[model samples]
Target: MGERRGRRGREGSAVGLEKYWASDPMDVLRVRQDFVLADVDTGSAPGFEGKKREAEKSLAVGAGILAGLQEQLFAGHQMGDDPRRILLVLQAMDTAGKGGIVKHVMSAVDPQGVQLATFKKPTEEELAHDFLWRIRKEVPEPGMIGVFDRSHYEDVLIGRVRELAPPEEIERRYDAINEFEAELAASGTTIIKVMLHISMDEQRSRLLKRLERRDKHWKFNPGDIDERMLAPKYREAYQVVFDRTTTPYAPWYVVPADHKWYARLAVQHLLIDALEGMKLDWPLADYDIEEQKARLATG
Candidate 1:
């Protein structure tokens, strides 16, 4: 069940979803295919409640394995002479469970080796600099895993959605992003961008449930309602962005997030697959074993 091999159980499990599972890849795909689709109220009863429990257990087990593999990367495993750097970026609409995904997916990684940056609205300082400045500060160092909870993509997603920048400016920024990502890839960073796709109904249900549960009420933001109102606009913006920006060097995975469990599993599997190919070997120094043994014998 180590992270490298944990995904074997669910490589195609999504393709085999049963009707009672409450969520299916095909259903989520349909929602995306028809962007004009209305957001229904799935909160009355979680469509996949029965199947959710089993999925959760599977995800927990998979996450445990992934953590261990991440440890191997930290331990200085190398594929040939090249050490690897992994930068994972998770993007999603409101309440698509970005935080939850980070918590569960990266739970096992060593804290020092993993840095998580969650980007919200730009600050005065961040805005003062180029869009990539704040992001540049968060890139993973060699032999580390960096997780950007939101990331530079916002300059494309939200900026375009709100018309914060002009058309020419937006076109220029996409080229900037492509170059930035290409540079990261060329420098040995494995850049994986994930876009978590959640249905409007699912989001609405989550928002309401957050309101009903006092303990979770803190997560309820009135602004989210406004964002929900802008859902179609955002989807249009995302579709355009996806088409222009999904690169071979840094591909985008549109994760079906209506089922949080499935979403988490898909990401974990993808990450594990990327890392397994790395085949890291522990880094060794020049010390001779015989000399070390002699020193030990002297002691």
Candidate 2:
């Protein structure tokens, strides 16, 4: 589906996102010293002033720009020499729409250029290694976009809330993660860490809907209710994560995710912004185009 976009997508920036966005998301959605998860209105769309209709329009426009930019990055990797890549780290509670972002926003680019990794329970082998051992193996190669469905932060989030590890060991992983990401950034990985923030009430509604529909029965997990019971602790764990891991090199953006459309659009803009910052150009042809054209004509 996305392959055709590479052939005719626009090269210019999609300005509607910039125009409708009230300010840089970093200034609004990024964690601040005074930021509190409880204070965030889950339904609110921070940094964007546009309504759903306008946002839908902006999303369509951005898709073209995103597709074209991805083409350039992929070209640099497969056909030319380029070292830059992107790692979009997504952390959220169940049903926060991580899969939706992957489907709706990332579908604009060719699948070959996108690498997706979902981190679930560690096998006995993975458990024997350090927490990041498996994660490091999934890092995207040059000129590709990498996504983490649920990432290393789960160690601190679920780990702390459930007391899976000793408190001291959990503490150590925080610094370990920071150093690991800094190293990746130095090696030319553009890291975008995002937390999809959803209200407990909204979560309840979604879960109820899943129960009502036969099709959604497969998605419902009774364990989710058990997890929901510990929402307060999870929120506190997330707060600690923000306090320690949010840094200049790999900052976190807590996207309000109650509205699935807004969350998708916001993440699309974030990806576009990260790619735009790269300032990459389409790789020039290695062969002489004129010579090839002349040879074809003579034949």
Cα lDDT tens digits, model 2, 152-243, are 99999999999989999999999999999999999889999999989999999999999999999999999999999999999999989999
lDDT of 1 by residue, 113-218 (tens): 7878899999999988889999999898777788999998899888988887787888888899999999999988888888787887889899999999989999
Measured by TM-score, the strongest candidate is: 2
Off by over 4 Å in 1: 1-54, 77-82, 293-299
Computed on alpha carbons, the lDDT of every model, listed in order, comes to: 0.73, 0.87
> Against the true structure, candidate 2 has what lDDT?
0.87
Work out candidate 1's RMSD over C-alphas: 5.4
Q: Candidate 2: deviation at residue 298, Å? A: 5.8
